[model samples]
Target: MRETRRQTFDEVDLLLDNARLRDELEPYRDESIDPSINRMPLHAENEYLASMLAWERAPALPIAEWFNPPLDLMPPDSLSDAQLSSLLNKTIERLFSKNIVLRCTDHLSDRELYMIVYRDILPCCEKMVDVPGKAIEWMCVEDTETWLRYYASAVERRRYQEERGMPLPAAETPPYRRQLPGQ
Candidate 1:
């Protein structure tokens, strides 16, 4: 008869505990993927701080194995992918909720907000579409009939910046300002 090591429920529980321990150790394994909880305002008795300190002081940690694992150590390619997916999902959820709230408020028609968000605002946000995390961009429509009225606000802003000697975004030189070499 061959003797095999039979496992009990307690051993199974112990294995679960070990797996939990590994899960707990996951964040420390990757510095870049680690959440930056430091941005939050700190209190003397903050729970976050206490937990962070406690995590810092664990003994017999497989630090070397955790930090120096092979490329296939993680379940997926990178935690960045997880973070990006999380952000995009959250943004979509938030946007849906916000649309619901806006609809209920009756302050602005659904069509109005839809036009701004889709046509104008989304174009500006194209610059940030590649960026990680959630950001809401809005566009405002100006009702100006004449050229003077249309450009008055922009002119004021430019003049104000000029007067204050503030560095404004580079403006393209007018055709008149471009002197020919023979001139």
Candidate 2:
């Protein structure tokens, strides 16, 4: 008869415990407690875990401190169209340099985007937590309905529709398309 070696359940349990211990030793071990962890698919969970790990190790800085020269934005109401345009362009460049990016900007006009930069973003005193390989996001503030209608993914739109118990209005593309950073 041939000799055979079989693994016991206790041995398997020991192996699993070792694996769990290794995961706990990782930088983002605490992120395992994220409520959506179980709901996400394997790949998405992996990505999220990686992002969480990066965030855990990254340095935190205020938005004002992120820039070397510091920002000098004019008040929205005081700027002419040409001045606003020039400032907006320069600001966008500066934001991109600092790994900050705008999301759902396609829903807003150029003027609206500039206004947001002048009013909401420039004046805000929030600290940015920088994660490697992740760009800080500035999403559209006004006209959320328009963003949801045109820019939100199909699944999000469907969920919104279901929650409201009414059909959503058709998506219409915005008149202007501002190129987002790190496209």
Candidate 3:
């Protein structure tokens, strides 16, 4: 009963939030997607609009800036193989703390993975959403090769074959497989 009541939207709050969202989103207004297609009730409609506003107004900052204690790392090229391995483990844990999960990573060496995080992932601009337990899985490699060889399920492989009419890569054990921290 308490949970259900908590989930119920307050009418006054809904209107206030919706108005604020409209104002914030005005400068970045894009009418590419028709809002009328979403037939949710008033409260839900406001939530959908609010989410859109969140993404629109989200600052393009480094992932380090997303955390209260900045997640700083040594330059990847400066580290030896052993140091890189240690830093990579620590980095993966820190990323998981912010619900950033690395996927399709078993194919790369420790240095390679760390370099990707330092060069590509950390500097990349993304929405720093604070949704609890909802992880954003970052695909670490170029999508097609690793995904086709290791990650894609049979159904997905068949769908790709049917859709693209291309030969599927044979599935193989990812060369550097090991357990990482859980999301």
Backbone clashes in candidate 3 total 0
Off by over 4 Å in 2: 1-62, 126-130, 142-144
lDDT against true structure, model 2: 0.68
TM-score of 3: 0.75
> How well is each residue in 50-73 modelled by candidate 2, as lDDT tens digits?
565555555555465567667867
Runs of candidate 1 exceeding 4 Å displacement: 1-106, 129-134, 137-183
Question: What is the Cα-based TM-score of model 2?
Answer: 0.62
lDDT of the candidates, in the order given: 0.36, 0.68, 0.80
- Score candidate 1 by lDDT: 0.36
- Sort by lDDT, best first: 3, 2, 1
Give the best candidate by TM-score: 3
- What lDDT is reached at residue 32 by model 1? 41
TM-score of each: 0.19, 0.62, 0.75
lDDT of 1 by residue, 1-183 (tens): 123334455456555654565466566656642355445433322334344334455443221121223111222233355554454334334443322111111122333333443343323322212112223233132332221222235677577577787654443322222111111
Task: Using lDDT, give the best candidate's number.
Answer: 3
Which segments of model 3 are wrong by more than 4 Å?
1-9, 32-34, 67-70, 129-135, 178-183
